[model samples]
Target chain A: DTAVSQTPKYLVTQMGNDKSIKCEQNLGHDTMYWYKQDSKKFLKIMFSYNNKELIINETVPNRFSPKSPDKAHLNLHINSLELGDSAVYFCAIGWGNTIYFGEGSWLTVV
Target chain B: GESVGLHLPTLSVQEGDNSIINCAYSNSASDYFIWYKQESGKGPQFIIDIRSNMDKRQGQRVTVLLNKTVKHLSLQIAATQPGDSAVYFCAALRAGNNRKLIWGLGTSLAVNP
Candidate 1:
């Protein structure tokens, strides 16, 4: 069983479309995070939730919003997606100083 | 905003040799740091970690060094193998925030056979 899993491993859509990516972790972690890995292999933290409360939010766009139904799941919803949003999105769980990541969801905006 | 960065975008090393990956962090308030390895088409895997109170920690074939003076961190791998080839990243946790980890751009390590 995967400790962390994400839905829609690959997403392809047109610009201005709305899309969502779902993530879940079974590791019983209190903290979950959303990260974006760009074409340059730069991994940036987009948002972080600890116990369903937002703990960290970087300079991300307004079109992107994250929702946490519970401590085990965090979903990201993007509105009016743009070509710049074409990247691999990852879900991660933080336990102490160690963090575990999901397989990642590749999103492409054509 | 403060960030963690690497000295190089890529690293090439021969198999069986030791490998060292370096990182520089701008935030002294960071209390914890980690090293992760990401292969193609996959998410990052945790390698090792160091806390602000410690200078170094080791596990298996990996070792992490933290220098709070220069705000620097380094990962050392023993007897690098071909399977060790991947992008390595350094991330830091804010002093008060345990969930948030500031990530680096990553350094691609190419292990030559």
Candidate 2:
């Protein structure tokens, strides 16, 4: 019974291929976010959705798209993956700025 | 210009010892602070949090101290055990319509038995 869970815990794909990472939260949170952690362990926010509405979209590339079909789910799709896109992606759910994170999905673009 | 950083990259402590990890933030608008523990090959886990109005908050065996004047935040763990070994991160959360959460570089803590 995890509060937050993500699919494709580890994925290896060729460059230019497309892939998606899915996330869901059972904590009844109104806000969900996607954060990318680089090799340096620097966590950068990519997108934030509140009640399935796009709230905060960072300066990420257009190839990276986030979709929230409902408040419980948020999925990220990356097109034309690059070597620089190889990093751990985290899904977080929260309300009022306090967050709970998923186990993380490691994406490796070769 | 907005960033959160840790003072040390790594920290080592013996079992039963107290551990202190420090962080500094440049954004004065941030009104909330949080500490997270990320174990190897796992996502970060929330540890503790404090508000700008409070100077200190404690949870279980962990304590978070916030110094708004100096923009410093510290997490203190009592009776550090090997299980407590992980990378600790401090994040600053700005309150308002624009929700920007700034994360620190993280401090790796190794507790020896």
DockQ values for all predictions? 0.70, 0.70
Cα error, candidate 2, residue B94 (Å)? 1.6
- Mind giving the per-residue lDDT tens digits that candidate 1 earns over A17-96? 99999999998888898999999988888998999999888899989999999999999999999999999999988776
Tens-digit lDDT track of model 2 for A45-88: 99998888898999999999999988899999999999999999
> Which regions of candidate 2 are displaced past 4 Å?
B96-98
Residue B39 error, candidate 2, Å: 0.4
TM-score of chain A of 2: 0.97
The models' CA-based lDDT, in order, is: 0.91, 0.92
Candidate 2 CA-lDDT value: 0.92
Docking class of 1: medium
Per-candidate TM equals 0.93, 0.96
Could you tell me which residue pairs clash in candidate 1? none
RMSD of each: 1.6, 1.2
